[model samples]
Every structure is written in C-alpha cells, then in structure tokens.
Target: MEITLVEGDITAQRVDAIVNAANSSLLGGGGVDGAIHRKGGPAILEECRALRASRYRDGLPIGQAVATTGGNLPARWVIHTVGPVFSSGEDRSVLLRDCYANSLQVADVLAASSVAFPLISAGVYGWPVEDAVRQALTVLNAVDPAHVTEARLVLFGADTYTVAERVAAGFS
Candidate 1:
C-alpha cells in the first residue's frame, strides 16, 4: 500500500473513509472526534446515537471499531475507534495499533479503496507524539495492503507532520 503523509485536517481529506479518534461514548467529543462529527453533520451523530441505543449501549470497547455514514464529509464512510487513554506507566500500544488495524478492516468491508488516519491517541489522550507516530507506522507497514490502496497519515499541524515525516521515513 502507498502511505501518503499530509499536513492538514483529516476531515478535509477526499478518500473512501477517514478514521476518527473517538471516545468510547461514540458521541462527539474533542479533537478528531469533534471535528468529524461537526463537519460530517447530523447523519453521523444519528447513526452513533442509534448504535448507543442498540449494539453499543455500554459504549464502544477500547481497540474496537465501528463504521457509520460519513454524512457531509467528503468520504463515503467514517470509521470510529476509541484509542486507549495513554498511561505513562502502562503499555497500551496494542490498543493504539488496534485502532488502525480495525479501521482498515472496516474500510475493507465497505470496499473502500483508500483511507485517511489521524494520529490516534496523540491529542487529548496524551500519548507522546513520537511514540504515537512510530506505532502507527509500524502497524500500517505490516499490513498486507490488498484491500486499501492508499493509507494516509493526515497530520493536523506542522510539528506532528514533521514528526510523522521523520518516523515514516524510517519505514518505506
């Protein structure tokens, strides 16, 4: 697969799907979750509320992902995944990897040819930026790339873009 690195908003990407670094509630929260919900409009929230009322009444489990209509966003669908809250003393990297892996799986089910990803858990979740970037690259690099042709690391700022570019350079 080809991984494109971009320094911009994930919400603005024109792709098959975009991953939201959401909270377990699946309702709109801060950072990427808030942006996707706000820009994607009510359809996304409607599906999420229905999800809560039915399948996800207890909230989405960490490392699990679900898909919903992209609504007004450019993408055909939105894949929501809750990244584990970062703990300095605990190794929650597996949960972080699951966010990407599971999102890709959902995209495949949707027959999405491309997907864009934000740095899951690196924002309000308080993950160290460098480690977050490394983990993302590692997971994406190991994947078979049969389903999705393109996976983009949509960086929201220059600092993280620089960081991502550096870490990704170490990969392909």
Candidate 2:
C-alpha cells in the first residue's frame, strides 16, 4: 500500500474509510472518538448502539475492529478499533499493531482503496507520539500492496505529523 502522511482533521478526508481510535465502549468518548461521533452524526452512533446490543455488548475488544457508517463525514465508512492503554510494564506493542492491522483487514473487506487513520492511542491513552508513529508506519508498510491502494496518516498537529513524516521516510 502507498502510505501518505498529512496533518489534518480526519473527519474531512474524502477517503473510502477512516479508522476511529475508539474506546472499547464504541459509544464515543474524548479525543478522536468524540470528534468522529460528533461530526459523523447520529447514524454512526445508531450502528454502534446496535453493535453493542448484539455482537459487542461487553464492548469492542482491544486490537479488534468493526465498521460503521461514516454518516455526515467525508468517508463512506468508519473502521472502529480500540487501542490498548499504553503501559510500561507490558509489551503492548502487539495490541497496538493489531489496531492498525485489523483496521486494514476491515477496509479490505469493504474493498476500500483509500483509508485514513489517526495516531491511535497517542492522545489521552498516553502512548508516546513518536513511537506511535513508528508503529503505525510499520504495520501499514507491511500490508499487502493490493489490499489497500493508499493509506493516509491523518495526524492532528505539526509535531505529530512531522514525526510521522520522518518515521515514514526512515523506517524500514
């Protein structure tokens, strides 16, 4: 897949899919989750509520992903994945990778050629921004080229987007 890095509001990206850095509840909380819910409108929440009532009553599992309508947002669909809380005592890197991996899996299932992502877990979840960028780039770089034609790292600030650009450039 082709990985593009940009500092922008993910809600405005006119892509096929946009990944949500959701909490397990999937009901929408602060940071990226709240923005997506608020901008995407009630249709997104309605699907989330239904998902909770059926498949995800206990909440979405960390590292796993599911899809909902993007509603009023520019994208056609939202791939929601709960990222693990960063912890120093454990190797949560795998869970972090799964967040990106599973999101891509869902995107492919929808035949989405272009997808945009936020820096999952780097906000209130307390993941280091640089490391989060590295992980996102690494996982996205590893996907089968045919599975996704373009993957955009839709970062929110100059610092985060700069780091993502540097990491994407030097990371093998």
User: lDDT (CA) for every model shown?
Assistant: 0.92, 0.93
Off by over 4 Å in 2: 145-147
How would you encode candidate 2's per-residue C-alpha lDDT over 71-155 as one tens digit per residue?
Answer: 9998999999999899989889899999999999999999999999999999999999989999998899888845579999999
TM-score of every model versus the real structure = 0.97, 0.97
Cα misplacement distance, residue 46 of candidate 1 (Å): 0.3
Total clashing pairs for each candidate: 0, 0
lDDT at 103 for candidate 1? Answer: 90
Q: What range of 10 consecutive residues in model 1 has the weakest lDDT sum?
A: 138-147
> Candidate 1: where are CA atoms >4 Å away?
none
Residue-by-residue lDDT tens digits, candidate 1, 1-172? 8888899999999999999999999999989999999999999999999999999999999989999999999998999999988998999999999999999888888889999999999999999988999989888888865679999999889999998888877765
